[model samples]
Target: MLVALGQLAAAVVVAVGVAVVSLLAIARVEWPAFPSSSAR
Candidate 1:
């Protein structure tokens, strides 16, 4: 039971980390478009 709990916690942490990284990556990818779009 303890092992399962530990695994669950690890999974949750990994998921959160991945989500944060992906969001940052997506923002980085889209960030350049904003400036040119507003210039139009």
Candidate 2:
């Protein structure tokens, strides 16, 4: 039971980290478009 709980906690942490990284990557990808869109 303890091992299962530990695995779940680790998985959650990893998932959160991946989500944050992907969000940052997406932000960077769309960042250039933001300025050009406003310029138009």
Candidate 3:
């Protein structure tokens, strides 16, 4: 039971970490595009 709970917690943490990393990566990719678009 305890192991199951621990695994669940780890999974949640990993999911959140992946989401945050993905969002940051997207933002990084789009950052330059925003400036160029505005400059147009």
Candidate 4:
């Protein structure tokens, strides 16, 4: 039971980490586009 709980915790941590990383990546990609659009 302890091992299963540990695995679940690890999975949750990994999922959250992935989500954060993806959001940062998307923000970085869009960061430059925002200024160019506004400049027009």
Candidate whose TM-score is highest:
4
Candidate 4: deviation at residue 1, Å?
0.7
Model 2's number of clashes is: 0
* lDDT computed for candidate 1: 0.85
Tens digits of per-residue lDDT, candidate 4, 1-40, equal 9999999999999999999999888766776656874457
Q: Can you write out model 3's per-residue Cα lDDT over 1-38, one digit (the tens) per residue? A: 99999999999999999999998887667776568744
For model 3, what is the alpha-carbon lDDT of residue 31? 71
Better of 1 and 2 by TM-score: 1
TM per model?
0.71, 0.70, 0.72, 0.73
Off by over 4 Å in 1: 31-40
Which sections of candidate 3 miss by over 4 Å? 31-40
Candidate 3 lDDT: 0.86
How many backbone clashes does every candidate have?
0, 0, 0, 0
Which lDDT value does model 2 have at 31?
69
Q: How accurate locally is residue 23 in candidate 1, as Cα lDDT from 0 to 100?
A: 85
Model 4 scores worst on lDDT over the 10 consecutive residues at 30-39
For model 2, the stretches where C-alpha displacement exceeds 4 angstroms are 31-40
